[model samples]
Target: MGPGEVAAILFGGFALLIILRVPVAFALALAVTPVFFIEPRLTPLLLMREMFKSYNAFVLLAVPFFLLAANLMNGAGITDRLIRLSQALVGHLPGGLGHVNVVVSMLFAGISGSSTADAAGIGSLLIPQMKKEGYDTSFSVAITACSSVMGVVIPPSILMVVWGGLMSVSIGGLFLAGVIPGLLIAGSQMLTVYIYAKRRNYPVSVRSNLRELISAVTGASLALVTPLIIIGGIVGGFFTPTEASVVAVLYSLVLGVLLYRTVPIRRLPSILYDSARFAAISLFCIGTASAFGWCLAYFKIPAALVSQIEMLGLGLIGTGIMVALAFLIIGMFIDAIPAIIILGTVLMPVTEHVGMNPIHFAIIGVVSLSFGLITPPYGLCLLIAASIGKIRLVDTLKDVLVLLVPMLLVLLAIILLPSVILFLPRLFMPQFVG
Candidate 1:
């Protein structure tokens, strides 16, 4: 078989493994074996070496720290202050507290960096309150599911750190680029909530006076400062992303221990274990993907694919569209980590060839897959949101479909213009390159 044909078959086999529910790390290792055999540069020994090399980066050390920070915030009763603060700020709006949940989640997302955390913590507090206000249970769950996606886009996101690790991009720059867009999506989501509120003639609650506002802000301030501190330090050259994460861990500990005093000191051990456990899974998957990518590189698969694409003479915009669509489709089935790792091998090279910044492509790639966490039968965060809110998956799907247009438009803007991500990093830190 021809080289191109062989590459296609190997890629197909890897995808099939993911579809069959095989773990992503295993899928990468399994799919890579044949390509290694087919192409002489990829010895099994070299694949093992590649896997070892993956975690060799000091930047990758940021993943566990960010993850531990998230776990710390979640366990330390940070969500309660956020929820209370949100209620104080927006509980008086029509549809009152539902709008509050979205805004609060957007606010907290900067710190949590996880849709699962946003969904679980915010949904727990707001869903029941939503039902108490005479809102549809399904709609309540739906909004919670949708709003949680903000966690990925907001600053201090571990997922962005993961992207930085994979692509050698500036994680701080990525965080800055995301701020405006994240707020834009939050505005869109708030509008969606308003539409439902207006349609239902929902009653607005009035719980906040000036004093209450001051109190709520003060309460949420500690939890809120973590993101600003982490991002600011990274951008201001005060710390690397890894160091920023360590600072976040300390900051979160203060919130949980000295400031809030909700979680006992003894609880830190279990939280560390759980956070490390989750971090290990992601790291292993990334490592295996590194091994798989090494095999593909040895075979020169990506370079060969680029040659074939240029022969099509499709031009840059056409190729960008094609790549975006492909990532979206892949996103529907595979989780973001595996998708990024696999795409980093084949697709990232195309962007580089086109003179696109890896950072810009990373933003596009992340947003495209971020939508996947809300769609269909396999959206992990969506399922979690639904279960917590006590609504059926179909109900949440309907709400998510409403926002898909805006989501796609945002992705298109990132891909077509590229400046949506690039301009910020350039304006703030000219030296930073993805």
Candidate 2:
């Protein structure tokens, strides 16, 4: 077979491996093995060199530290405090319980940077209340799952960070770009919840007493600072995102261990151990994807694909539309992290050649990928919320469709108009160009 055919088979095999639930790292390495032997110019040493070189960047340093911070915040009861804070602020509106679920998801997105974490954290707190408040179990669970996508779209998103490193886009710009869209999604969800609440008459407590409101603010102020600290640390030039992750860990530790005093020092080891495991998965998949992309390049997949597309005359807008559609579809099936790793590596060159902004593309990519976390079937958040609400996936998936429409429109606007993302980054930090 030609090298391209060999590469095609390898890619097919890789997809099969993923479907079979074989780990992505194994799938990636296996996909690349053919190139190692077939192309003598690309030796086994080349693959290893690629892996080592790929991971050698200082930016990659932030990945593990950010994952660690997420783990610690989860373990230290930081997530719960933040949930309560979101609830206090938004829990009394019609469909207030649903709003609480989403608002909390967006807030937690900043801290956890993982949609799964968002689902797990906010689902545990909000789902029961939603059920008790007379929301349909399926609808409630679906809404919870849907809202968790905000984690990746909001700043400090792990997916964005990965894309930033891969595409050489501005991480800060990506963060800023996500700010308006994230709020838009949260607002959309809130609006949807309001409509649902009014239509169905879901239970809502009377707006909280002023004393409770005041008390809620007093108690939750510390937790609210988590995002502020993250944004300021990165935006103010005090640290890079990875550096900010370390700062986050230290900050969460200080608040949880010293000030709030929830995360016991003795329990730190377990937190580290848990975090290490998740981080290992992230790094391994990343290294493996790098290897797989190397293998693809060895066979000239991007160049071949780009040539074919360029011939087809699908200009930037057409390509963007098609790519956006594909991403939204795949986002429903795959988790954001590895999806970004695979697609970003392959499509980045094409995007750049078309004169697209890498930062804008990353924001679009992450947000587009986020749909997969909440959609039916393979969505990780769907399952998480289902488990919490004890709702069948089939029953909840329908309602999720209603919310998906508006979300897609918002994504389209961002894709067509690059300014939504680039504006804030330019306004605030002109110097931090990717």
Q: Count the backbone clashes (under 3 Å) in each candidate.
A: 0, 3
lDDT of 1 by residue, 1-434 (tens): 45566677668888888778887779888887776676664467777888899889898788788878888888887888888888898888888877898888898798878777788778887888888878888788877877888888878776788888777788888888778667767877777778878988877888799998899899888788888798888889998988988898888888788877877989989999988898898889888888877666656788888888888876667767877887788778777787787775688778777777777777777777777778774577788877877777876676678766666776777677776667778888888854
Worst 10 contiguous positions by lDDT, candidate 1:
35-44
lDDT of 2 by residue, 1-434 (tens): 56569657777887787788876678777777766887666688888888887788788777778777777677767666666666678888888788888887887787877787778877887789778778889878888888998988888888878888777777877788789889888888888889888999987767777787787677767767877888887888888888888888888788778987888889998888887887788887888788777776767777777777788777666777767776777666555666777777767777776777777767777888888777755688888889888877888878998887778878888878786668898898777643
Sliding window of 10 residues with minimal summed lDDT for model 2: 330-339
Candidate 2, superposed: residue stretches over 4 Å from native: 1-3, 432-434
RMSD of each: 2.1, 2.0
On the 0 to 100 scale, the lDDT of residue 363 in model 1 is: 73
Hey, what RMSD does candidate 2 come out at?
A: 2.0
TM-score of each: 0.93, 0.94
